[model samples]
Target: MNIIALKSVDLAIIALYFVAVLAIGFYLKRFATSGQDFFLAGREMTAWVAGLSFLSANLGSLELLGWAGSAYQYGILAAHWYWIGAIPAMVFLGIVMMPFYYISKTHSVPGYLQLRFGNGASGLSAITFAVMTILMSGVNMYAMAVVMKVMLGWNIHFSIWVSSLTVGIYVAAGGLYSAIFNEVLQFFLIWFGALLIPVFGLIETGGWSGMVARIQSNFPGQDFTHLWSTLGNAQDNPMGMHWTGIVFGLGAVLSMGYWTTDFLVVQRVLSAKDIRSAKMAPIIGSFFKMAVPLIVILPGVLGLAVLPEKLVPESALQAGQHSYNEVLPLMLARYMGPGLLGLGVTALVAGFMAGMAGNVSAFATVWTYDIYRPYIRRQAADAHYVSMGRWCTVIGLFISIATAYVAMGFASIMDYVQALFSFFIAPLFGTVLLGMLWKRATGPGGFWGLLAGVGSSVAMFFWVKLNPGALAIIALSDHAKPLAEDMYRALWSCLINVIVTVVVSLATQPKPLSELKGLVMGVTDIPKEQNVPLLHKPAFWAAVSIAILAILQWIFW
Candidate 1:
C-alpha cells in the first residue's frame, strides 16, 4: 500500500505547513542583512529558541528514519546512540566547554581552532567540515527522497529537487534565523505526528511488558528490549559491537566529537543571547534529547513486535518490497488515518528539510567566515560576507543534491553518516580536545597530528574493506555490518590523534600562558551559574542528568 493515505484535510495541513515555513523565511529576511545576523542571528537568541533549535536540528529525518530503521534492524542497542552516546557529552558541553567557546567569540568551531591552534589547523578543519556538512545535507536529502519514494510512490528525483529548492530559497533569504525557527516548528510537528505511534503502539501491544512479550514471540532468543545486555561480545549483540567498541568508540569518541565539536548543532547554541543562555542551551537540549528515543526508537521496537517480516534480513534483497528503512513510514501508514497521516508525512518531510538546512547554514557560515574571508578575500565588507553566505547557501545545496546520489550507494543512511564521522569528526575531536585542555599543544603539533589521524583513519578504512577479519582488536566479526567497522575505526583514529598530538607537542615549544588564557583548561576560568540555587546550577543538573541516564541504562539492561 502507498504510504500516502492523505485526504483533503491532510493535504491542507501539509500545505499550510509549507506556507508557514515560507512566511517565516520572508519575515526573518530583514533581520539577516548583516554578517553576524546572517550567520549567528546577531547573537540574540534566547535559551529556549537556541535550545529547541539545537535539539530539533538534530531530530532530522536522519534521526527519525535512520535511527528508527536502525532500531528495527539492531533492536534496543540502537538506543545507546541517544542515551550513553549523547546525554553526558551534551551536558559536558554546557558545563565545561561553553565558557571558552562564548568567551572567545569565535564564529564557528573551525574559528575556535584558529584561535587555539593556528590558521593551518583551522583551515584543514574548515575545509573538511564544509565538505562533511554538505555530504550530510545530501544524506538527509537522499533519506527523505527514499522515504517519499517508498511511502508516497513519488519520483525520488522530484522529491529531492523540491526539498532542495524549498530549503535553499528560505535558508538563503533568512539565514540562521529561518533555519532555527523552522527547526523549532518542525520539532513540534514531528512530535505531534510521531508520539501517536508509541502511544497507540504500546496500547496495541498491551503496554511495555506486553510489547516485550510480543517481540520475543516474533523473534525468539533475540532480546529486543535490553540496551546493554547484548553488548557482551561482538557476535552476541544485534549491532555486532562489543561493549568496548560501544563504550569507548561510540559512547566516548563519536558522541563527544559530534555533540561537542560538530558546528552544525554548535552554531545553534552559539547564537544564544547571553552567556547564561548559551550555557543553558545544550543543557536544555539534553533534556528534550533524552525523551526523543521514545518517539523514534519505539516505532522500530513496535515494528519488531508487529512487522517482523519487513525487517527480516533477506526481505530487502527480494526486490520490489519494503526494507528496514521503511519501518517508520510503514508504521505511520498503518496507524494514521487521513488528516493525521498528512500531518505525519509533513513531520517527516519537515525533519528532512531541517537537517539539510542545518548542514547548509553551517557550511555557509564556515565558508564565509573561515575559508572565503581569510583565504579567498581578506578585506571584504560585512555586506559582502553576508552576500557570500547567501551565495554559499545556493551552491552548497547544489553540491548536496549531487552528494545525495553518493548516499544512495550505502546500505543505510545511518551507516553512511557514521562513516563520514569516522573519517573526519573522530580525529577532529581528538585535535580539539588536546588543543582545548593541553596548553602545550603547539600549532604544528595540532596540524600534523590531525593530518596523521585522518591519514591513518583512511588507510585503516581501506584495510578493513580489503580484510575485515584482520582487525581482531576491533572485534570485526565476519557477519558484522559496516556500523561496527565505523565504531572501531573511530576508536583507532581518536587514539592516533591523541598520541601524535601529545608526542609532537612535547617536541615543540609551548605557547605562552598569556596566549593560552581563556583557551586552555588550566589557564581558563570556568564560568559559574551565579545567583542560582543548587538545583539550578549546571553542575548539579549535569549530575542529575547522568543519574537519570544511569538508571535508565540499568533498567534497560
Candidate 2:
C-alpha cells in the first residue's frame, strides 16, 4: 500500500523523536508553577534560543512543504515570501516594536491593545487571534497528513489524530516552555534532515545552472528562475503578479502584518532574557531565514526539472494524479533512502507537531489571559489560570482537528493560510501600527477601525467566493491569481483600517499624554542600552541582516 517504504530504522528514528519530545515535556512540568513561568518560559531565553525558536515557530506550514509547493507552482517568485516579505518586517519588529512590547510588560498583543486602546479593540483582536491560531494549526496538521498520505500511503485520519495528540500532551504538560524547546529542536532537524533533496537534485542536474537549463528545456518560454526580472507585469511571470503587488502588497502589508503584529511569533521574542535579547532575536532569525529558500525553493523548481509526470491540482488528485502539495514528499522519496529517509520523515513530522504546538500554546495563552481572565472569571488564582491554560491546550487541539477537515476542501494549504492572514493579520497590523506611532489614536477609533477592516476583508472574501468576477475588481487585475488576490486584499484592508483609524481618532478625544508613557512612541522615553558594546547592539545586527537580504535578491535576480 505504501508508495515509498520505510525500514525499521526509519520507524525507530521516528519513535525516538516522539519519546524525546514527551520526555522534554514531563521534564519541564515542574517549572509551570506560576502563570508567567507557564506562559512566558520564565523570561530567561537567550538571543540565540529565542531567535531559532522564533523562526522555527513559523517554520511549520509557512516554511517547509507549503512554500516548496508554491515554488513548484509559481517558480522563483515564491522567494518573495521568504526575502522581502519576511526579513524587513522582522528587523522592524526587533528595532522598533519589541521595545514597546518589552517595556510595557504586556502578557499578549491584545493585552497591549487594551492598555493603549480599550476593552473593545483588545477583546476583538484577542478573539480574532485565537481563531486564526486554530485555523493555522489546522493548516499545518492537514499539510503533514497530505505529505504522509502521499509518500507512505498512511491514512489521513491516523496521521492527524496521532500528531495532534502528541502535540497536545506535550504542550499541556509544559505549556510554552515545552513548545519553545521543541521548536528549537525542530529547527536543526528540519534543515539537516531535509537538505538532502536539494543536494541530491543539484548533483543529479550538475548544479544550479544545470538545474536552470533543465527547467528551461522542460518548460520552454516560461520564466521560473528569476526573482524580480519577470515581475514587471502579471503575464510576465508564472505567479500572474506585478512588481507593485510583490513590493507594496506582500513586502509591505502582508509581511509586516504577520511578522510585527502576529503574537504567535512575537511571543517567542518576548521570552528573551532582557530588552537586548528581545531586540536581537528577530535579527538573528533574519540571518538564517535568508537560507531557507535553498531547501524549500530549490527542491520545488527541481521538481519541475526532474519529476517523471506532470503534477495535477488538488481536484484531480483523487483521480490518481500528483498534486503540487505533494512535491516535497515526492522529491523526498526520489532522493532519500533507508536511514536518511527516516530522518527526513521524522523531520517533517516534528515540524508539523511543533507548528501545532506553537499555535495551540499561543491560542491557549490568548484565550485564558485575553478572553477568559478579562471576561469570564476575573478573580481566578494563579494556579487556576495555569490549569485553564492546560485544559485549553486540549480544547484547541480538538478545534484544530475539526479545522483540518475544513482544510481538506482547499487545494493548497498555503492559499488557505494566506487567506486567513488577510482576514485578521492585515487589519490587526493597521490597528497596532497606528496605536504605536500616533499618540492621538483613541479607543473608539481603534475599535471601530479594526471592526470595519475585518468586515471588509470577510465581505470581499465571500464576494469572491460567491462571484469569482469580484476578484478582478478587488485585485484590480483580470490576470490576477489567488496569490495576487491575497496580496492586494491585505493591502486594501490595511489601508482601510488605517484610514478609518485616522478619521475616527481626529474626531474623538485622545488618551491623555501622561497616560501614554511607555505605551506610545512620542510620549515614551526608551531606555538606552547602556554599556553594551557595538558588537552587542541590535541595530548593528539588523543592518547586517538587511544587507544580506539585499545581496540575496541581487544574486538571485
Candidate 3:
C-alpha cells in the first residue's frame, strides 16, 4: 500500500507531475526580476487565474485531508468550515473589501494596515503574520508527511524534507508568480484526484440515500448526516459545539478574519490584472468554495458509511484514539487501483506543496515590504527587494521546517492550525474591521487593541491548558473538545479587541478625514458601473453565491 510498491504507471504519473511543476517554476523564474513582478506577478493575472489560486492556495492539505478527516470525526457538521465559514466571507471580500485593497496598491495586508492605521500596527501585524504563516506552512508539511508515512510508508522526516526543499526552491526562484501558477495547476489535480473518491464511494454506498441508510443501519441511533440537525445545543452535537459558537465564532470571526485579512489568500486577489479582476477573483473562488465540502467533507461521511468501525472504534463513537485523518488516503486505497492511485497520491502531494508555497510566498512578501524594506533598508531598489524576497523565502522555508518538527507534538493538525488562527487572525480581524469601516479608529487604538486581543487569546489558551475545567465559556457540555475551546476563545478574543479598540479610539484623537481618504468606507466610494448588466456585476455574483450557499444549507439541514 505504500508509494514504494505502486505500479510503474502510477509512479510514472507522480514523477511526471513533479517534473511539470518544476518546469513551471523554472519557466516563470524570468518574470520575477523586480519586486512587483516577484510579489504580485506584475499585476497581470486574469480573474480565473487569481481566483483558482485564491481557492487552491487554501485547497492544500488542510482543505483536502484535514476536512475529510474532520468529516469522519465530526460528521456533516464539518461542512460549516467550507460553507458558512468560507463562502460568505469570500463574497464579502469581493464585493466590499477588494476595491480598497486594489485601490490602495498595497503589496501586502500589513502594507494596507500601514496606510489605514500606521507603522506601529503594520509592523506588529507583519511580524506576527510572518510567524503565523510559516507555522501554518509547517502544519501542512507535517500533515502531508503523516499522510505519506501512513499511505506510502515513507519516513516522515524524509517526506517532510523532500517536500519542503522542493517547495522552497521553486518558490524562491519564481516567487508568487510560480506559486500562483502551480496553485492553479494543483487545483485541477486536486479535483481530478478527489472527485473520483466520492463518485465511486456513492456508487459503492448505493447513492446518497443509500449511504445515509447504511450509516444508520451500521450504527443505530447515530446521527451523522444532517448539518444543522445535530447543532441545537452543546450536548446535541457530536463536536460538542453549539450553534451560537459555530455561527459567531467560526462563521463570523475566524472565517471573516482568514478570508478578509490573511495575506496568503488576499495576495492572490491582489495579483489580478485590475480592480474588476481583483473583485471578481474571490467571487469566482466562492463559487468553487461552496462546492468544496462535496470533495473534502463527503469523503469523511463516506468513510463513516463504508468504514465506520475503522474510523470510530467501539470504545469511542464521538471521541476516539483511532486515526480518522486517514479517511482520504483510506478511501483512495479502497477505490483507486494502480495508475489512478499514483495520481491520487500526486494530488495529495501537490496540495501539500501548494500550501507550503502559498505560506512562504506570503511570508516573503510581508517580510520584504512590511519589514525588510521599510525598517531595514529604507531605499532599496526593486531588484534588491526582489532578491531579499528570494532570500526571505529560503529563510521562511527553513523556519517552517523547524516549525514542522514543533507540530509533531500536536495531535490534530487542523486543531493546531485553528488554535494559531484564533490567537493571531481573529484579533487581527477585529482591528481590520474597525480600520476599514470605522474611520475614527486611531493608529494607537489599532496597535494596542490588536496586542490586547492576542494577549487575551494567549492568556485564555494557557489558562485552559493549566485548568481544563476553566473552559466553561467554550464548552457547551463536558464533552467539548479543543476545537470548541478554539471557537469560544476566538469569540472572546475578538470581542476584547473590539472593546479595547473602541475605548482607546474614543480617548485618543482620530486622524483627520482628509488623512483617511480612500482607506475608510465613508471617505471613499468604490467604482460603480452605471450600465453593466447584473450578471456581470460583482455584487450580483456575490448574491448568487450566497443564494447557492442558502440552498446548500437547506439541503444539508
Among all candidates shown, the one with the greatest lDDT: 2
Q: Which of the numbered candidates is closest to the native, going by highest TM-score? A: 2
Worst 10 residues of 3 by lDDT: 313-322
lDDT of 2 by residue, 31-135 (tens): 878899889988989999999999999998557888888899899889899999999999999999999999999888999999999999999999999999999
Q: Please count the clashing residue pairs in each candidate, in the order shown.
A: 1, 0, 1
* lDDT tens readout by residue for model 3, 397-440: 98888888666565566788889999999999999889989999
Candidate 1 regions with alpha-carbon error over 4 angstroms: 312-315, 471-473, 476-479
Clashing pairs in 2: none
Give lDDT for model 1. Answer: 0.88
Predictions in order: lDDT? 0.88, 0.91, 0.88
TM-score of each: 0.97, 0.98, 0.97
Candidate 2 stretches greater than 4 Å from native = none
RMSD of each: 1.5, 1.1, 2.3
Better of 1 and 2 by lDDT: 2
List the pairs of residues colliding in candidate 3: 3-152
